[model samples]
Target chain A: MTPRLAWRLLPPLAVAALLVAAWQAWVTLAAVPAYIVPSPRLVAHTLVADRALLAASLGITLGVALQALAVALVVGVLVAIAFAQSRWIEASFYPYAVLLQVTPIVAIAPLVIIWVKDTHVALVLCAAVVALFPVIANTTLGLRSVDPGLRDLFRLNRATRWQTLTRLAIPSALPYFFGGLRVATGLALIGAVVAEFVAGTGGQGAGLAYQILMAGIQLNVPRLFAALVLIAAAGVVLFSCASLLAWLALRHWHESELPPR
Target chain B: MSAAPVLAVDAVGHTFPSGTTALTGVSLAIADGEFVALLGPSGCGKTTLLSLLAGLAAPTAGSIAWWGEPLPPPGRPFGYVFQAPTLMPWARVAANVRLPLELRGSDRATAQRAALAALARVGLAEFADAWPRELSGGMRMRASIARALVASPLLLLLDEPFAALDEFARNRLDDELSHWWRDAGFTAVFVTHSIQEAVFLATRVVVMAARPGRVIADLAIDAPFPRGPAWRASPAFATLCADISRRVAAAAERAA
Candidate 1:
């Protein structure tokens, strides 16, 4: 990497190393029992030893998060377009959208799981519900935020409604929609993990949250620390993926995505 | 000059929805290929009148007719240059210029050629692929002008297009615009608050008074074609500018 990138990566890495060293010293000096708090080295060893099982759980959680995010994007953007076309439609349905947003998905996940026969489908739906609001709100605002002068210019050119929407409104909304997508990606991961916790489903289809629960019940402190590390790493990976996507979509023309000159 | 006028505004009156009377009994007749300048202070309804003439809006009372027919739709018949550049930030300069033709369903190849030619006219052909933000303010305004001209409008309405530019850039654009008008031979109605600009470019200067704006003076400049900086330094130019200045001040005072 370039020196600038190296500079950016250095501070975070240094702080994390210092904190890990301090925790290791405290655990060894105080003779703390591993059952209560595993040393960082023990957690690291468990992560390597239990790689296969942990990797499978991580895959399940990541799959659910990705699927839920896709569903949210497709449905949320379509609903936002409909809202842009009619103030009346937006007024009629926006309150219910807010209601869905306000209600806790964890409370509703049980009912969804009981009603939906497929566990995966139920979990994806739960995650989608938690992630849909920002996409709708931001995309709607973007679609409505067309420059008045540009709108007048289009009108003067006698543009058809379809032409106006495709050429103007959609492109205008792309930046805001991408912003929502970033937020939704993180929320989808959180929702998936939370739903898995609530369902407590296990065996072949178990996600990271299930592994985490099992490790805690067995008092396998090293395994618990390993599961926690995997979840944190997964969250970081999901966020980086979203950021990359936003940068790719908007780097050319968008004000927010432009690099400093 | 032809006896018959191409467009006529007959006793036009307008009161906005907010109960502000913007214009009252404004009347003018524009001859073919004549460069008319609308000179007035702020809030004088010059822009409102331009918008009406461009058919962006209808006058509240009376009528505006084009070639004795009903007012035509805006784009091909009338191109408007707003005070600001007003370019689509997402579009490249060429695409912005090609927009009107695209809206009219022109073939892509033909529209591209025409857009390039228009850009060439404004000396922006080299910057067709550049984004609006990459350009300076004056360059952005040129791109705006190129977009306005791409459709080959019969009448161009400019609403204080150079008012925001520095004095040097403004004067340079004024010269370029005057040259473009001479070559294209299209009817132009330029709205400006600059007294020197009004004197420099117009074939006929229509001085307006504010507070329900109405025409106060209609003076015809008898200067020759292709006026340059030499003409700007002439005694006749100074005399005309002074006369218009006095009338404008008197109109403002009378309104107060």
Candidate 2:
């Protein structure tokens, strides 16, 4: 790795190592029971022992989160475009969209589980619901933020509706869309875990949340800590991916992605 | 000169939606190949008149005709340069210049050639790939001018385009604009508050006054072309500038 990259990463790693060392020291010094709060060494041992089961559950959970995000991105943009096309349509429908967004996903997940036959599909649908609003809101605002002078220029040249939307509105909305993507990535994972908790599915179609639930019942505290670490890592990875996507798309022109002078 | 009237504004007046009167009884018949400057102080409806001529807006009281037809005759395009560069912040300089041709659905190869030629004309040939934010204020305005002239429209309208630039940039652009006008021989209407600038470029200076804007004088500028800094420094140039300045001051006083 380059010296710059190593230097940039140093502080965060330093902080995490200090925290882990303190946790290990406290558990050993206090003689705390493993079931109550597992030591760092015990949690690491559990993670290695339960690798196959945890990895399978993690794969399932991540698949659901990623798929839900994709669905939200595509559907949200289309809805935003429809809203952009007409104020009347937006006026009529936007309130309902906001209503859907504000309603707690956890409160709604049980109903979603009951309504859908397949538990996995229900989980994806619930996650998509939770992640949809940011995309719609940001993209709609960006579409409406077109410069008046640019609009006049387009009109003077007799640009068609499609041409204006594709050339002007879409390109303008990209920065905002990527911003929405970052928020939605985290929300999608939260939605998936909540929906799984509500459904309480186990055995063959189990996710990380199910593993956590099972470990909690059995008082397998080290295993539970291992599962929590996996979830946190997954969240961080997903967020990083969204940021990378945004940087790749906007680095050349956008103000946000340019290196600070 | 009684040449064909390229654009005729017959007693035009405008009141904006905000209930502010911008123009009153503004009538003019611009002849072919004339470089007319709408010289006035701000709020004199110089820009309002230019917008009407560009067909961006309609007059509330009267009509404007293009080539003896209604304003903005379809398929007959005109060039327009706004005060701001107005380049898409995301696009490269060449893409911004190429926009008009691309909007009209010209093919890729042809549009590329024309865009390069236009960039070269504005002395920005090498900066074609650079972003707008990379360029200085003067260069951005030059890119805007290049975009305006890229399609080679028959009538060009510029609304105080160099107002925000430094004096040196302003003077340099003014000289370049005079050369472009002389070479192209297009009907041009330039709006400005600077009396020296109006006298420097226009074949005729149409002086106006504010507070419900109206024309007060039409002075013919019979100065020789190929004007440079030497010409601007001459007594003849100073006399013309002084004459127009007095007329503008008198007109402002009359309006008050």
Give Cα-based local distance difference scores for all models. Answer: 0.90, 0.91
Candidate 1, residues B140-248, lDDT tens digits: the string is 9999999889888888889999999999999889899999999888899999999899889999999988997888999998899788888888999999999899998
Per-model TM-score, in order, reads 0.94, 0.95
Q: Candidate 1: which pairs clash?
A: none
Question: Where in model 2 is the C-alpha error above 4 Å?
Answer: A1-7, B1-4
Give the Cα-based TM-score of candidate 2 against the true structure. 0.95
The ten-residue window of minimal lDDT in model 1 chain B covers B69-78
Query: To one decimal place, how large is model 1's interface RMSD in Å?
Result: 1.2
Q: Give chain A TM for each model in order.
A: 0.94, 0.96
**What TM-score does chain B of candidate 1 reach?**
0.96
State each candidate's clash count: 0, 0
User: Residue-wise lDDT of candidate 2 within A77-194, one digit each (tens)?
Assistant: 9999999999999999999999989999988998888899988999999999999999999999988888878887888888899989998999889999999999999999998888
